[model samples]
Target: MSEANIDIQLLDDVMNKTVVSVEESKEKIFEIAENAHKENNFITLELETLRNEIDLVITQTDELEWKAKQARQRLANISRGFKRYSELEIREAYEMASQMQIQLSLSRDKEKHLRERRDELERRHRNILNTIEKSENLISQMGIVLNYLQGDLRKVGIALESAHHHQLLGIQIIQAQEEERKRVARDIHDGPAQSMANVALRSEIVEKMLNQNRIDEAKVELRLLKELTRASLVDVRKIIFDLRPMALDDLGLTPTLRKYLEEYEKRHHIETKLTLLSPERRLQSSIEVAVFRLIQESLNNTAKHANAKQVEVKLEFKPNKVLFMVADNGIGFEKQAKGERPQFGIMGMQERVKLLQGTMKIESKPGKGTILFFGIPLRIEENTKAGGSEK
Candidate 1:
């Protein structure tokens, strides 16, 4: 064959292979995007169902709260009139109080479970949306290359590079998700699950006392049960809020952060100070969530690893951007190379900032404390500004 013919055949072979690889990559991405869209829809329906369940539980809780309050008042009145009442009347009063206490405790537990379910559903929904966005972006980038290449030899190299980048991103996302799942599972086992088990054991003890005709002892057990249940309810609510703070939706970012830091300090026994430099204003929902998670992860890391006595967080709102910093006075460690074993918390924070087209920097030394700084541009919509003013 002529040299020209040989060259043309070689070029044709390369083009065919490149086109095949591009098509396969496109198909894979489209599959991912479609699955993500379906998951998003499923999560939306689940969230709606969860919200209805939560509303119902809230109504029931309110009723129980009222009834419990009334029962307590009746018990107090009975105590004052005990000298004038018969033995049966006093026993009946105590019995009524015990029943009311048990009922209220059960109702509160149910409400707590419902709220946790709702929060988990919401988190899943956010994750699905993120996956969809990433898949769509990858597909769009490939389309641009496909349009511009027109069978060029370099198309193969570019397509391969794109595919590799997408693969790495997918791995990173999966790793982050797994890490999150582990954290949540650990928290549930240690916090609410343990609390619930204790409640069950106490309830059993109360039942045994009542069966043995130890009315007075049973009454005391009931009282202890009430306190334990109330405390457990608080713990469960805190877990749910940490999973996804409702204040982030109702009160906006600044208020939510302030409230969270206050709780964090009390819980961790680490003095935490928050400074807000901007006039309290709301940002887009996505940005608000990202910023909240960034700070949350930062403080969590500090609590677990820093052993610091105090941590400082600051937020500054700019005309077209927002900046955040989390600093801790604790034993620091050597910074590892980016390619080293991943620090999941730090990596997750970096990924969140990257998604917002923002910048993140971490500074640490063996003796000095660690500092994390991130900034992201904000597009202040008219409606957002108006909403801020209302707040």
Candidate 2:
């Protein structure tokens, strides 16, 4: 039942077999001490083995801590990588949006410019159309005028032919008169004028000799001949210059006029002034010639008819036109007096202007000076050059 009772019985049995004594008990105790020492030794060995196991566990725990830190660093790196990628995507998106906005602005600007250009072109087109309409109306009126003039001329021609046979005779008479004037002028220059120059040369030599008291009678002839030669040359030069102006052929309208006006001033003692703004640009050759002739005719009329002290001639450029104005303080015309001879100069000027489709205006009264205006409508040429596209 108990370890003590079992042990007493085992000892009593051992004693029956052999008498038990203190010496044996002592021996048994010694043996027990020896077994206890061995058991303690085994316990010490087990403790050392347990301590080694604990040290192994500690090393394992340290390895686990290191692995945990490495996992955290990897996670942080992944997160940062994600954040950087997101930032790059955002910047790219923003830049793309900015580029799109710039493109849109440029497109809008271009569209606005195109719209303005279109409007300007349309406005110009409308103006050109209006100008054309006005021109057509004016042309129609001119056509009526031309037709009326043609009819009047025909009626006048028939009446004159029937009633006035001497009309042709008068024309021939005027031509004969002109030819006679030319012949006289030519004869004066060739015959008497040349003879006078020869006489003048001889007179100069005779006069020089006479100054030395040689040939008194010959010196008297020489003096007379020299005076005659000078007078003849002056008269001949004046007449020839008036009849045929060399300046007219040599120079254009303005230059010829300048030289002619100078001569007019010297001859008539009239202060004729001129001012020109534009250089003489090239014109149709016929137009230039016609203009020159017209001015010449107008000036002749002024000199003959006008009792004016001063004359002002101005040529100016106008839009689609050119203006030539001759103003003078002179005896004015009486339009009411139909009996007076028509100023052939005025009528001729009007006819010439008509050929050019130009307008001529004459402003005059009893006291006031005559202002002859020759307004040339250069619109045809201007329109042609402009392609009729500018109003």
* Per-model CA lDDT versus the true structure: 0.79, 0.60
Best by lDDT: 1
| Model 2 poorest 10 in a row by lDDT | 145-154
CA RMSD (A), model 1: 18.8
**Deviation from native of the Cα of residue 331 in model 1, angstroms:** 2.2
Candidate 1: Cα lDDT at 29? 96
> What stretches of model 1 exceed 4 Å from their correct place?
1-182, 205-224, 277-280, 337-339, 379-391
Task: For residues 1-391, write the lDDT of model 2, one tens digit per residue.
Answer: 5885676567556544432343344355445544543444343334444444445555554554455555555545655676655666655555555555555555556555555555554555455445544543443334333333333323442355453544443443444334335445455746565566456455555766678778877757767776877767787776666556666566656777788788878877778998776545444445556566667677778789888888888887554666788888888776646566556567667666776778888788867878888877665665365444444
| Structure candidate 2, residue pairs in collision | none
- Model 2 residue 93 CA deviation (Å) reads 99
Model 1 misses residue 133 by how many Å?
31
> Candidate 2: misplaced stretches above 4 Å?
1-228, 231-251, 277-279, 318-321, 347-357, 377-391
The per-prediction CA RMSD against the true structure, in angstroms, equals 18.8, 63.7
